[model samples]
Target: MMISYADSALSVLPPLLAITLAIFTRKVLLSLGVGILLGALLLTDFSMIGSGEYLANTVSQLVWKDAALNSWNVYILGFLIVLGMITALITVSGSARAFADWAKLHIRNKRDAKLMTMFLGCVVFIDDYFNSLVVGSISRPITDRYHISRAKLAYILDSTAAPVCVISPVSSWGAYIIALIGGILTAHGFADAGHLSVFVQMIPMNFYAVFSLLLLLCVAAFSLDVGPMRQHELNALRGNLFDETKGQPPGATTDLPEADTGKVIGLFLPIAILVFATVYFMVSSGADSLAASELPFSVLGAFENTDVSSSLFFGSLVGFIATVGLAIQQKVEWSMLVKGMVVGARSMLPAIYILLFAWTIASVIGQLETGKYMASLATDNIPFALLPAVLFVLAGVTAFSTGTSWGTFGIMLPIAADMAMGSDSSMMLPMLAAVLSGAVFGDHCSPISDTTILSSTGASCHHIDHVVTQLPYALITAFISIVGYTVLGFTGSLMAGLISCSVLFVISIVILHFWAKK
Candidate 1:
C-alpha cells in the first residue's frame, strides 16, 4: 500500500527534528541520539498501541532486528575502527610529523603549500574521510610554516575530497554508484542487465561533479580567495595560523602531552599495507568483473568477501599490536605505549560519536522508508521535462540534509529511473548524471558531513570556521552547476554543457585571483 502524505510526514518528523535540534543546539551527537530514540518511540507506539507485551516486542524487534546487520552498517563500523587504529598508529610513530617536516623542506611558498594540500587531497580521493585525516595531518605543519590559516587549509581539503571521489571511477564511492545505477536501470525496465556501463557512460555527463573538480583545480592554480577565505588567507599572510596552545594539542591534553616524534615509520606501516592490500585485491578481483557485478554478493565474492574496511581494520589492529610490541622491544615503558593508545582513541572520540549517531539516524529513516516516500512524491508532481533539474535539486537537498551522498543516491536513483521510464523525454542519462552530481554537491558543503568534519579536523581548523570559509566557494561552484544542468536539460547535450561550464569556471577563478591580489 502507498504511504499517505501525513504518515510519510510523521515518518520524517523525527529526523527533521533531530537535524533542527542539532543545528540549533550545536550538539550533534546528542541531537542524533534523540532523533533515533524519537523514531524508535514513534514506530513502537504506532505498532503496539496499549499492549505492554506488544510494546516490549516492538522495542525488541527495533533493537535486535536483522536489518541492523546490513552490510553498509558493518562497513561503516569497520571503517571507523580501522581509521581510529591507523590514526593512533600514526600519532604514536610520529610519521605524520616526519612527513610534515619533510614537506616543509620542499614547499617554501604559501601558494605551493596550498597547492600541495590540494594535490594530496586529490591523491587520496578513494574515501573522503581518509583524505580528510591524512591530508590534514600531513599538510598542517607545512601550511603552518607558510602561515596558512587552518580555516583556509580546511576549506581546500573539504572542497577537494568528496568532489574528487564523486568523479573518480575508482574508490568506495564508485562501488556505490555502480550499485545505485544497476538498481535504477532495473527499476526503469532497462534491459542492459547487470553491467555498469551505463553508470560509467554517465560519469562524463555529471556536470556538477566535473565542474566542481575544475573549480578546485582553478582555485588552486590561480590562488583565488573569496569571502571568509579572504580573511583566512590574510590572517595566514600575517603569520597567525593556529595557536597550538589555545585549547589542547589535538589528541592530547595539556598535562599529558606526548612528543611529536616517537616512531614514525612504524606508525605509517599499517596504512601503507592497507593501501597495498586494497590495490592488490582490486587488481586480483578483476576490476572490470567487479565493476560489472549485479549484486552485492558478486562484488563481495570477487574480493573473497574481504572488504577494504575489514582488511584495514584487521591490518590496523595488527599494526597497533606490533607497534606496542616494538615499544616493548626498545625498552620503552608499557605505560607510555598505553598512554599513546589512550590519547589516540580520545582524539577519535568526537568522530566516533558522530558516526554512531549518523548511522543510527540513517537506519531509523531507512526503516521508515522516508527516502522511498520522498521519491514517490517527487515522481508524482514533477514533469518529465523538468525531472532532470528537479531531481538535481532534490538530490542536492537530500544530500545536504543527510550529509551522505551515497545515502541520497540510494534513495533517489531508483525513483529517478522509474520517473524517466514514464516520461516522454529522452533525457534519462542527463537526469541520472544530475542526481549523482547534485548529491556530491550537497555532501561537499554540509557542515555535519563526515568528509567536511574530517577535512577541518585534518587541517587543524575549527570545524565551523572551515564551513563558513568554504561555503562561498562551494556555492559558486554549485551555481555554475545549476546553470550547466539547465543547459544540458534543454539541449540534451552533456558535452556542450560541461565545456561551457568549465570555461566559465576558469574565468571566474581568474577574476577572483586578480581580486585577491588587489
Candidate 2:
C-alpha cells in the first residue's frame, strides 16, 4: 500500500532540498534526481523495500497513471523531439541566416529587435509551450543580429508565455483554468453568467500576469534591464551572447551548415505552417473532445477541451514536413538533410533528460502531498482581510516547491474558494485571482519548471543561466503583485489594488533603469 505524507511537514523537505541544490550546483538533473530519491525515501519511511516500491510507482506515474496511458507526457516529449529537428532543419538550410540578414534591413536597433520579440510573444498566446518555442525560433535571428543576450531572449520568452496564457480566454491555460473554476464555482453554489466571464473578470485582478507583461515592455522599451539581466545584456554587447563556459546550450546551431542560397520563405513558411497547423489541430482536438461529451461547440469551449500535447505533436509533425520540403527545394543534399534531422533531435536530448527528471521529481513531490501540506498552513485562523495576500503567498510557495502552476492551481483554487465561501464570500474573486497570480509567479521562477526549461531551450540559452538571470525580474513582479493583493484584501477595492500595482510597477522600472545604467 502507498503511504500518505499529506499531514507531515516532512513533505516539503525533498523539493526544498532539490531546489536549493539546483540553485547552488547548476546541475538540474542531479538536483531533481536527489529530490525524487529523498521524497521516495520519506514516503517509504526510509525502508529499502518500501522506497524501491515507492520509486517504481513514481516512474510508472511519469508515463502511465491509473493503468491508463499518460498521453500528455508522451506527446509532449515527442513534440520536443520534433521541434528540435525543425529548429535544426531551419538552420541547416540557411533559413536562419537568411532571416537574420533580412531582419537587419528593417530592424535598425536593439530596442526594435526586442520589441518585435515581445510582440511575437504576446501574439502567440494559444499555448505557453507553442509561444515559447515558436517565438524563440522566429525572433532569435533578429535578436541575435542585435547582439541581444540569449539569456535576455529567454527571459522575454519566459515572461510572455505563462502570463499571457493565464489571461487569454482562447489559450490552453485559460481553457483548463475555466473548466477547473467551473467545478469550484459549482461546488460552492455560486451562479454566474458562465465560467468564462468569471475568468475574464479575474484578468484585471491577476496582478502578477498583468504586471509581468508590463515589466517586459518596460524592459524592452526603456531598456529597464535590472539585476543579472543587466549583466547579461552587457556581456552580449561585448559579443558574448552565451556564456562560453557552459558549453553549447540546447538549440545551438553552430554545427549546422547553412546554404548560401537559402531564402526567407524557408524560415517563414515552415513556422507559419507550424503556427496555423497547431491552431487547427488544437481546435479540431477540442471539437472531438466536446463532441465526445455531447456538448455544443464554441471556439472557447473547443480551447477548453483541447488536447494540447497531441495537438502540438501533430502540428509539429506537419511543420517538420514543411521544413524538409523547403530544404529539398533549396537543393539541400540528402546526407545534410539526414544530418540536420539527427543533430536537431540530438540537441533536444539534454532538455528531454532534464524534463524527465523534473517530471519524475514532480510526481514524487505530489505523492508526498507537498502541495496539500502547504495548503494546510493557511487555516481558518487567517484574517478575512488578509486572505487574498495569504493565499497568494501560499499558492506561490506551493508552485515554487512543486514546480507546476497547474498542480498548484489544482490544489489551491478549490481551497481558496472554500475558505472565501466560509468567510467573506465577496472576496472570492480576489482570492482566486491571488492564487492565479501567485502560481504563475512561482512557476515563472522555478528552475524545474517545464516552461522555464523550454524557454531556455527555445532561446538556446543555458538552462541555469536562464533561471538565474530571470529570477530578479520575476521576483520584482511578484513583490509588486503581493503588495497589490494586500491592498485588495484590506480595501476591498479592485481599482485601488490595481492602481497600487500599476504605480509601483512604473516606479520600480524607472528606478531599475537608472540603477542599471550605472
Backbone clashes, candidate 1: 3
Looking at model 1, the pairs that clash are 93-263, 93-264, 136-458
Model 2, 389-486: lDDT tens per residue? 89989999999999999999999999999988888888999999999999999998888889999999999999989999999988899899889988
TM-score of each prediction: 0.80, 0.98
lDDT of 1 at 310: 45
Tell me the spans in candidate 1 whose CA falls farther than 4 Å from its real position.
1-13, 20-25, 33-94, 186-194, 232-270, 278-308, 318-335, 377-383, 514-518
lDDT of 1 by residue, 1-518 (tens): 12233336676676778767765665666777777776666665644343344334444443355656444445544555445544554554455556566666777677888888888888876666667766665566577777888887787787778777776656667766765666667666775664356767887778776766677777766677788787777777777664444443232222333345455454455546555555555444444455566534344234332355544445445555665654455455556556666666676656655665666666566666666655555746655656777788888777766667888887887667767666743777777788888888777766557777667666766555676778777778777777777777777777767877877787778777877888
Error of 1 at 278 (Å): 4.2
lDDT for each of the candidates? Answer: 0.65, 0.91
Off by over 4 Å in 2: 64-68
